[model samples]
Target: MKNYTITVNGNVYDVTVEESTGAAAPAAVSAPSPVKKEAAPAPKKAAATGAEGSVKVTAPMPGKILGVKVSAGQAVKKGEVLVVLEAMKMENEIIAPSDGTVASIHAAVGDSVEAGATLATLN
Candidate 1:
């Protein structure tokens, strides 16, 4: 029997190896236990809702919509916050791209959105 220390992907582990002189039969390996399978989650939609010619505000990444700051028909500035998103346990503020009236809000609180998914529109 021999023991060795191995480092894999920056993780260190201790391993033991047994040497055989070809005098004994190999040990049998038991069948692996059945694994539990889980149903696939529904696909995420990147749908954007707005009137034609309206500026679309999109999410930067996949996350839950934490809050909608501006309502429909509200006037906002170019750098004003439009929505709050919760991602990776952090809160992200979605800002407006230009000064405009909020034409419509497509995302609600607690809604999950994908990257580049429009959350609102401005006109």
Candidate 2:
């Protein structure tokens, strides 16, 4: 049996290995203890009401808002890009549900959003 001390990303770990003479059996490895993490601060609420209109444009997946293409009170067409979200290393466009005026923008650039969360409201 041999023991080794390893450090990864400033985390220390202890490893043990057994020598085998004949049969090739899989060696058991124990993972390092999990590091303690601080809880994230709660997100602030948007100043304007998110539910501003009858039609809602929502995020398709969890991601960060890369850009907001439309502003409040702006007229938009169906399939027009309302917001650009970056998720899983890909950019996804959140489009208007129908031709209408943008009543409100619930997300801003660099804001993290969840799937199905409202991005904009159309009137």
Candidate 3:
């Protein structure tokens, strides 16, 4: 038998696994107790206009919005950080794809967003 530690988000779990020599099926391991989760509210309306020629900045992964670095009408350069996201206990920065004006911000700080969710637009 061997023991291991696994972390999800910030929670750590102790797990044990046994080695088998024969072809018999291994013992079943009971899953951890399910944590009660509050239902997520419906997504708030995005305030950005989907104007022609605008580029959408999307979330790369599901995470909570940590910070918004630009506002509508704010000028941004390529490679500038546009938003900060916290996923799996790590901070990820989303940057502008090209030099342009921020058309709108669809997410606010503390909002939980999904992967591919539009965060903002640039034009």
Candidate 4:
């Protein structure tokens, strides 16, 4: 099977197709395609406060933290990864909520976190 993304009316659709073979045909053929709807977009991250203030970092999805990139008191960029979470056999890096100092870490490596769970705090 093969997958592809098609755009129609300015909207994107994911489609999968299966290949077919026959003895009489010199070449392969493809079956009818199937379209799969993708999940809705995730909520937007909270606005960044450049000044001194606590920024709540939330998990993007349910997953286990495979690695931690920032420690408390460490300075970070606006989109720096503070943790890496493994979900659906894929590792996803959790970025900092804002450009500031790492105030605290709520979840540690090997810890499982649900979507929207507090992962860290930034100053």
**TM-score head-to-head 2 vs 3, winner:** 2
Q: What is the TM-score of each candidate against the true structure?
A: 0.59, 0.64, 0.61, 0.56
Query: On residues 1-123, what C-alpha lDDT tens digit does candidate 1 reach at each position?
Result: 676665544445565666767877874434333334433455675444445326988999999998989888789999999999999999999999999999888888889889998889898
lDDT of 4 at 74: 87
- What lDDT would candidate 1 get against the real structure? 0.80
**Models sorted by TM-score, best on top:** 2, 3, 1, 4
Which prediction has the highest TM-score against the true structure?
A: 2
- Report model 4's TM-score to 2 decimal places: 0.56
Better of 2 and 4 by TM-score: 2
Tell me which residue pairs clash in candidate 1: none
* Local accuracy of candidate 2 as per-residue lDDT tens digits, 4-119: 66666555566677777767787666665644443345668666543498898889899999999988989999999999999999999888879999998998889999999988
Model 4: which residue pairs collide?
none
Cand. 2 Cα-lDDT: 0.83
lDDT of each: 0.80, 0.83, 0.83, 0.75
RMSD of 1: 11.0
Worst 10 residues of 2 by lDDT: 32-41
lDDT of 4 at 123: 79
CA-only RMSD, every prediction:
11.0, 7.1, 9.8, 10.8
